[model samples]
Target: MKKLLKRIKALIRKIFQQFSSTLEPSPPPSYHSPETWIPPIPPVPSFAPQWENGLVLVCSQCTVEQFAGSSHRINRSITATEELQNWLKSRLKFDGLWGKYRVISTSCLGICPQSRVVVVLRNHLVGQQCLLVDPQSDREILYSYIKQMNQ
Candidate 1:
């Protein structure tokens, strides 16, 4: 009984030592200068339109994941499609034309492939319109389309 008790105690100690080693906290790094620290800017809230005229570009979910890629590759959790939508919204907001146009992120619009991001520009006056775009599309083309839609 004495030998058995000794063995059990030794086993328990060994197990605790292994567990404690894993729980050990990492050492703190050497102190760095305050200059080395840079505060991150907080995200701006979504812009709310005052009037609503020009057109709304709906970015579908199908394109969201493909454009965003893995979290490691993309800095913002926002996908490529979302980035485009936000850019449009910001442009309208900064220009104080929030009443003139709006860009919205929408769910899967049934269109997949064609490279991740799909945009549908709808103008009340001109009627509904759709444009399928991929990540590889030229920026100029997108701008031109927007310009034409506004006209």
Candidate 2:
């Protein structure tokens, strides 16, 4: 039993040594070559809403700054903009109203007090109107509003 255990330990050590010796150090990643460093694909351009089209949701004064005990406290600062963009994309897709309107994600709409975000609907009839939306507001409300404006 002792011999067998010794042999197994010896074999394991040999195997590890062989593996370590044979392993070639990986070269540092090169960023100079475009082929080697693939840039992420840009987001698809949002469909322009037909005349009197879609709503634009903006996140104004979005930063690491947070109000105490507010819902925005846990929100990630960097992706706030991306989150708004993606939200518009998903809302448009889920509502089955993708091509019918435009959903824009614009920077700082100048309404800083309204939590972390502000939504605006721009169409021929409504011109430009600001919407005060709760973080939990149903996206369908915006869609329904747009539909009504179209009629």
Candidate 3:
């Protein structure tokens, strides 16, 4: 039993020595000094297509709960934005009007309503108008407002 314990202790020491011998030494602190490093050049930024009239930024993070009878479901913000985009495309298709407007699904605009997504409209005339849009009810009103601004 004593001889077995002695062998185990010797094996552990040999394993530790092998592990230590396999490790490479860390570099000296002076090797990573700031004066020896060169700064990397940053790339120029590219922008989206320039719109003539305006653009709409819809919040993709907004989630709204809808209840029907006994069951309820959450409405995704993306579908609402897509619906708004389609509506805009259909209504504003007159003599380059559609080309001037853009609908973009963006991150949260920070005005997250409990039952609606935040829609920000920007044009040369109005500058900017932030509104909470209910997809089912506010489509017509929103279209009219955007039309008024473009004209």
Q: Write the per-residue lDDT of candidate 3 for residues 29-129, one digit (tens) a residue.
A: 66566656555579999876657689877776664222222165644444666677677777777545776788777887777676676888988777999
lDDT of each: 0.66, 0.61, 0.73
Best by TM-score: 3
What C-alpha lDDT, on a 0 to 100 scale, does residue 29 get in candidate 2?
63
Q: Let me know the TM-score candidate 1 reaches against the reference structure.
A: 0.51
lDDT of 1: 0.66
Candidate achieving higher lDDT, 1 or 3: 3
Q: RMSD in angstroms, all models? A: 15.9, 12.4, 6.6
- Tell me the lDDT of candidate 2: 0.61
- Which residue pairs overlap in candidate 3's backbone? none
Top candidate (lDDT): 3
- What TM-score would every model get versus the actual structure? 0.51, 0.47, 0.56
> 2-56, model 2: which lDDT tens digit per residue?
9999999999999999999889665546755644765568898786446346456
What lDDT does model 3 reach?
0.73
